[model samples]
Target: MASRDLVTGKIFSLQTIVGILGNFSVLYFYLFLHYTRCKLRSTDCNLKNLTVANLLVIFSKGVPKMMAGFGLKDFINDFGCKFFFYVHRVGRDVSIGTTCLLSVFQAIAISPLNSRWAELKVKAHKYIATSNIFCWILNMMLNIILPLYVTDKRNNTNFTQKTDYGYCYVMEDGTVTMKIYAALILCRDGFSLVLIVSASSFTVFILHRHKQQVRYIHRNNLSPRSSPESTATQSILVLLCTFVSLWTLSSIFLICLTVLNNLSLWLRNTSALINACFPTVSPYILINYDSRVPRVCFA
Candidate 1:
């Protein structure tokens, strides 16, 4: 095994382990809250789904990349490749949709009574479960074709136009059908990006206004303790920013890989690393900001 493979394998191993632990902790914390009859927020459902989706992405993508990095060549069959890639793509897309939904929901949750979003604030919580179900269904349907393009690397050694992802190969036929599917995926992600950005911007504006009001009320000294709403808003903003930055980086690498047929091992691993960043980092971010976590831990 090359030194590069050894190094990447170690990195993936650490990342996957940490990500799994973090997400599971968050999921368990939320589940405990639910079963113990604790007061739950409307957006708790969204957080639960987000953690699950993040787990899917980490398991499906991170595990395979980890295995491949360990120099496990031709270990996966065509079916395995298809299944893993299909799950990864679905999970990836769903994560995006859920994150967007969470941001929009948070924005509405904080909207002023007279604002246009105020009406949505009343009904938004009721629709969160339905929205999550719809997100899963839509992303699954969109990514169902992904398996058709992926196959175990050893099986398609002769293909001239293929993206070798270490453990598996994505055979691109350069067909109009493939192009159309790519465009559709891009469009879906683009729409989600717009929603997330708009919602996040609204949240920042609200937070700014809130701070201004607090300052006006207590001009001598700022409030010693942040309000629950302010803390939640700040945390969600941080999470959203992290997601967007990492997603953008991963997308750039993905587009480059799509356009370039030749295998670039460094690029492939780097992309995988970037893609795993959010799932690995996001759970801890939530845990840090959620006050309930400390209580639950000590209880």
Candidate 2:
């Protein structure tokens, strides 16, 4: 049993490290380019926000998993446990919020000229950063109360249990704390999911419309190849779609586990891995699909 646990931990730790390092590298390139020559356009700002959110996810969730793998769970004392979990929960929410915002911004950017939100494009860059900052502060404030509801138990006494597993919530006899915590998590996740779905759907609809228009223009010989902006927009659409799909699947799994209450440890851990893997894979796609990279490299 010990050997099995050790192997599992090692695998997860390595996976987390790879994901974190990959995201950091991609963020560095994007930031450096943006500062040197690339102006802070709406698109660039959105991407930067996404990268920052990814960094938080890596630190809060990925690093803890890595530490747990190395049997450093004890390093997280009572205070450490509460703070770590707090950050982990809040960081994940922020990531979801930022991604949803990115999708909405991108959709609005590509909306028809006469659409209701079309005017937003002109002034969006000015306020997008402010909005992102608000999101971070809002989420942090909301999650500040989490530690009050959580604590570390030394052993399985009544409602508290210390099994081979690392950190967990042990339901005390007749205490509604665990249920309350679960409900809060559900509410937060559900709210973010709704936003993600709405934004992703809107972006997909606009992308399809734009693609059709591009095809029509090509058929009439009005244009030969897609415009550079169009190409970049399409790439972002793909990335957003991929992110939405992966997160949706993982969210579904989480909902089932939380509600049905029959998931095994393997299934739970697998879901965590899936959630982490999306941000890990996103950076690679961003770098490879970025059209300006070649220009920047050559310049």
Provide the overall lDDT of each model, using Cα atoms, as 2-decimal numbers: 0.89, 0.69
Per-candidate TM equals 0.96, 0.83
Candidate 1 per-residue lDDT over residues 180-260, each given as its tens digit: 899999999999999999999989998888778778657667566887767777888999999999989999998887767
lDDT of 2 at 131: 81
**Model 1 steric clash pairs:** none
Candidate 2 stretches greater than 4 Å from native: 153-188, 216-224, 260-264, 295-299
Best by TM-score: 1
Give lDDT tens digits, candidate 2, residues 1-299.
Answer: 36655766787777777767777866777767867876544777767777777766667666666666566655565676677667776767777777777777777777787888868876766778898888889888777766665555443345342222255442323347656656776787677667767766777788787677677677777747666667777677778778778888988877766555435666766776777777677777777777776766576
For candidate 2, give the lDDT of residue 9.
Answer: 77
